[model samples]
Target chain A: MNISSHRRTRDRVVTVLTYAAMVFVLLLPFALFVGLAVKSDLLFREHSLGDLLFSSVWRPSSGEFGFKPFIVGSVYVTLLAMLISCPICLLSAIHITQYAPTRVAKVVTTAIDILAGIPSVVYGVWGMVGVVPFVGKIAGWCGIQSNGYSILAGGIVLSIMVVPFILNILMEIYRTIPRELTEVSLSLGATRWETIRDVLNRKALPGILAAFGFGFARAFGETMAVLMVVGNVVKIPEGLFDPGYPLPALIANSFGELGSIPEIESALMFAALILLVVVLIFNATLRWLIIKAERY
Target chain B: MESNMNQGKEGRNIERPFAEGESIIRVDGLNLHAGKTHILKNINVEIPKNKLTVILGPSGCGKTTLLKCMNRLTDLTPDIKVSGNIYIGEQPVFGSKTDIVALRRKMGLLSQRPFPLPMNIYNNIAYGLKLRGKYTRAELNELVEYYLRQVNLWDEVKDRLRSPAVRLSIGQQQRLCLARGLAVNPDIILADEPTSALDPVSSEAIEKQFAALSKDYTLVMVTHVLRQARRIADYVIFMYLGEVIEMRPAQEFFDDPREEQTKKYLAGAFN
Candidate 1:
């Protein structure tokens, strides 16, 4: 066949086979995560894995399994990170997009581009070496734990890490706004703030909200940075400042100590399953919001 | 056509060749610079009160630029210098410490694209009046209803005021934009290629609406379409290459265009 005709001709068998194989490849890890979590046979080798998932006491010796604490810690950190990051990220994005003089906008965008490129591990190390002491001092003053390794400290670090993500996503969203809308609003005698509040923000708010969900997803899945600052206590955190072990920390801690108890290993896998579900849900929601945002 | 209705009252100036006699806005020696390149050159014209004046031009002819200058919208761009006396009514527009908001209150402009604020239909129309605080809930409701009805969109949208203006069809959105502009009670309305994106039906509807609006508000429009210029213009200003080639009564303009380029343009020999 001629090259033009060949390009147009669809081979139904190849197309179907190709799509099925592609789906299988994509589904490989998805299937694995679910398989490892729900497999009752994996429970035979060491019931500790299944026990820690369901028991109130998560210790392997007593065969107590309870995943509620790690789930709670992840929720706390993610929520705290969102609380700290959302407005700051949006304001920064707005400033860069609308208020900054052209030169200032250029510089701010460049800075954020560089900030977003910084590795999450480096941010984690910074939280450990620099942020920990500062947080300790502040927490002590507030009659909270003197340890820097608290859910609050980790959450703040996660916020710092996710702010760039929020700002970058929202900046792109802001750029998509037609110049006509802003010019019309400003021409109508709306002040800078009014134009942004009534015209600009309302226009971009959907994408900004989607960015918040993405930031939460990133914060929820964060392991190393949260691990460094969070005290890794399995108990439920009493306040923002209290120490807690998130799912990633639980997974990380149990990985090295897996030799000590086989049930702990099972529980770690169970925790992995939970973290996987949470991040997936967050990602799905974020994607839905972004799609909805584009429709508007 | 309804344009003829509005035209009969305002087009003639006691046998003075039908210049914009009431002179709602006077432009004298206006020089607009875009990065040191003069875009509007030594311009002089008068736009009449409560009449439709259409500015016809080839592309890059500075008609849209001139429309924006009336409200100082051009000032928002950096490196664009304007040296001109643009007087709106009795006030010197370019140099007044005029409440930019209050100044914007007196005039409204529609862009080529219909940029209804990323807001509901009601809020889009309510935006301007709310800014200037002319809105009692009853007044705002009355005004929105009045303007929407005036734009011939009230019946279609009265049920969906909370729906985002973006959801409207392009023609409906343009009319919604017109209603938004009128909601604040502006004396002058400038439309820049307002129907360029719509089908013939929409363009005709907008033309009819502009004719009706001219009874109460001064209307200025910039268009590249000669047929549109013929249909709605009371006074036609023809611009070619950033200069006003001719300003004449609309009938005289279409009947015997003064400039060769204007003749060529009306004859459809390239923009």
Candidate 2:
């Protein structure tokens, strides 16, 4: 009886500790959001939300802070990256899981792991050295003036960085599908490609969307690599070759210069808040879509 | 009986005299190895046309491997070496110029558990039809209904043909898988313990369907259950340790004592 009571007490203590840990994890994002909002309250009180979001003029000395250019830049670069990476990731993942020999697939998986493990700063330097010049040549061929750093360069580098992320997820999704399903399709006389197109791809569509969502979020918030190649100019980009500044770049580049200035600090905090909220919304929307897709 | 003497093995070769043009599939000296481990050893058998042939053995006896070799489903395994010839009619299964898709179309497979394709009920049947050729929507609808009714699932699922097939009960999903396989118009049906994952009533339903189907399609089934083999098998191939111990007509093989292994396996002495 004494031993039973002791066991019960230990179990209850462990349960309470786990619940406390879960609550702490659940409250972290809310705590961060509240802290950011409180710090940005001064800027919010001085400038209307619409003016702060939509106004293009961003002169910090005169207290004119506008986030429209950075917002547009983040969207353009992220979308371009996704457009380049999604097809490549999807096809390569299919090849790895469905067609490649086991040894070759293992080799390719290890290569992707190495790519994913590389530091982001290294990618930034590589982008500065290789991609910027390539983009400059393309711009020259297209009759546009560029000194290598541009949104296109940023997009190219971002796409390369996110390839491993998206491909790993896609390969895992394809692998998790039961082998029996594929054999069933084959036994039904469907060709291997037909089985992939008609059955396996359809089954993996929701997971594919989720993978793209994660890639998009990663690309949107990337700082050092994008800042290195994106030609951080304070204006809205007119085209792919033009220079622009994303939100993360803006906060990263200016945070050190705002010494003893509450207005500038609040504006930067507001940018961080916007970044967090947008990523949260994007992830939530993807979750909703995945759930809906699974229901059918 | 045109009996052939065994060359070196201890087992005797049982070569029953088959009627002319009766055998639909023949395996000659088939041997399979996964990596270095031999899975099937010198398998020689003939599956009769339009008959239910059950490959009965204990677990890991390569019964399913033998069935998979008929349709070349074993090719999916990695590092597996197969040295043998399997003939469906007069066509060689592993010929270099063989059209694998066409060969697969001639055989349908039912796995241990039901794997309804990730699609709606109607599309599950229609998918196979669509792969063969283009069909009008009306034709697709008619054929889907016909195949669903073939498996005795039409009345139960006719109301919600558009619903996802995964929503169905396990029994219904198995029936749907049958309907999907039958829609392709295969000449042979390979079932790998088709009723093992089913309840008793669903098992009976599947058994009745198989009995009905064997009149039109050749069936090669793998099962370890002696009662199930006794109940439905028209011909029995008893395998032990990757070798066929006896291949005989179901009634004769069960009644007469032939090999010691076959007798012990039949008398519930060993699995």
Candidate 3:
């Protein structure tokens, strides 16, 4: 047997093995999710799919299950978190790339990287201990008497945890701008501030929007930190101070008790399916936006 | 302080071209250092007003650095130390109280490669005028058209002023950059090999525009091409190894040729 043919056979075996492994890893979770959802739907066919998706009655004892409140809670907290994190991340990125001294920028970049690596449970503990009381005080000043655990607290905690992720991405995008472009603007009698506002920001708009999408998707799916802070009341919040339960929080809190009520388990599986669908949509949109940015 | 440094030069006859028609830019005893590498050493010359002056040198010999220094664009580079007395018109460029924005407004620069603002064709030209002061929509429109016309880009792009400037060809983008620079109405135009990236026809178009523009503005260009220097330069400064080796009228410098390095460079020995 020739050595070349022996090596070729070995290479073919390795390539086939890698492809099989990749396909298995990609499909395992999706198969499990669909199988569990179908099983739950067949086992408990009392509540219709609409009732499981849109109705807010979530009492498991009387056999009523709905996920509307969790869906709304997830959207509200995520949007508020995005609203808080986007400007802070963008401005900090701009300052680091354009205004701050090199040494200071390096220090800030290191601090942000450290923040990105911190565990979610640590953020939850910090939010429970530190930010919850601060939010309660601010709410009290606004003449709304409330406990500290609320949607605002949860959103604030989520924003703090995810800021470094968005900041690092945006800073990397801003740094890709060519030095010649800025110099050309400045040489045209533009002040430094004008150059940044008119030239740098305009050029990086699409990438900035993409960063926002990434932050939103991450915030929407966050589980542990939000679960600790948000009072899991399972209702649509009327104000920032009102307590609410998001989908991920509900799933995390109720999964251990699934054996008691089969219908609750089915409903929770459906919620997970919803989350999967929403995340898929977000990722698709993000990919399309990045391609659009590069095209022009 | 300025004259004393030049007078101490041991044996070189530094050509004083300051006797020509009203000198617009004068550099005396300019020395530039980039992190211990002496980039430009004791440079002295006068660029006359309303004439095309070419700073002729090979690559890395400090011609581009000198052009950038005139507008303080070298301040963008890190660890650069510049010591010199440079005057544009009557204003001191390196003085402590100089307003760099206003100083830059008096000069227009065309780089080697074209980079139009990441905007539409109309906005690229309108942005600079808007930064200067308020202008009515009609006034700005007329001004944009006038400037584009001056660069001969109006006929090609007049129909698609709102389209993104990056959609244009490389040659058109270069011309748009020229229009954008001229929209600010600068007194002097500094070009760092504006035609180096261009095809022959596009390069000829730019050279023709520069010749016409020299009647109204002081034009200073840097080029390593001996043919380009001879074709367009009214006054020429020949530099080699970070020092000015010769400064003379273009006709005399090309025909009679004073320095040995300039002669070798002109004979196509090596860049």
Best by DockQ: 2
Which residue pairs clash within candidate 1? A48-A263, A49-A266, A49-A267, A52-A65, A55-A65, A57-A64
TM-score, chain B, predicted structure 3: 0.94
Over B69-122, each residue of candidate 3 has an lDDT whose tens digit, in order, gives: 999888777678988667787787787899999999889889998888988999
lDDT of 3 at B32: 93
What are the per-residue Cα lDDT tens digits for candidate 3 across A1-296? 56798899999999999999999999986896777668577435787777877888888778887788999999888988998999999999998988786788899999998999999999999999998999899989999987878999999999998899899999998899887788889889998888988898888878887888889889999999999998889788899999999999888888897745766777677777778778778888888877776534
Better of 1 and 2 by DockQ: 2
TM-score winner between 1 and 2, please give it: 2
Runs with alpha carbons beyond 4 Å of true place in candidate 3: A1-50, A283-296, B1-15, B18-21, B267-271
What ranking of all candidate models by TM-score puts the best one first? 2, 3, 1
Q: In terms of TM-score, how similar is model 1 to the real structure?
A: 0.86
Give the Å shift of residue B175 in candidate 2. Answer: 0.8
Q: Please say which candidate is ahead in TM-score: 2 or 3.
A: 2
Candidate 2 Cα lDDT to native: 0.90
Please give, as one word, the docking class of candidate 3: medium
Residues A21-77, candidate 2: write the lDDT tens digits.
999999999999999999999998889999999999999999999999999999989
In DockQ, how does model 1 score against the reference complex? 0.53
Query: How high is the CA lDDT of each candidate model?
Result: 0.80, 0.90, 0.86
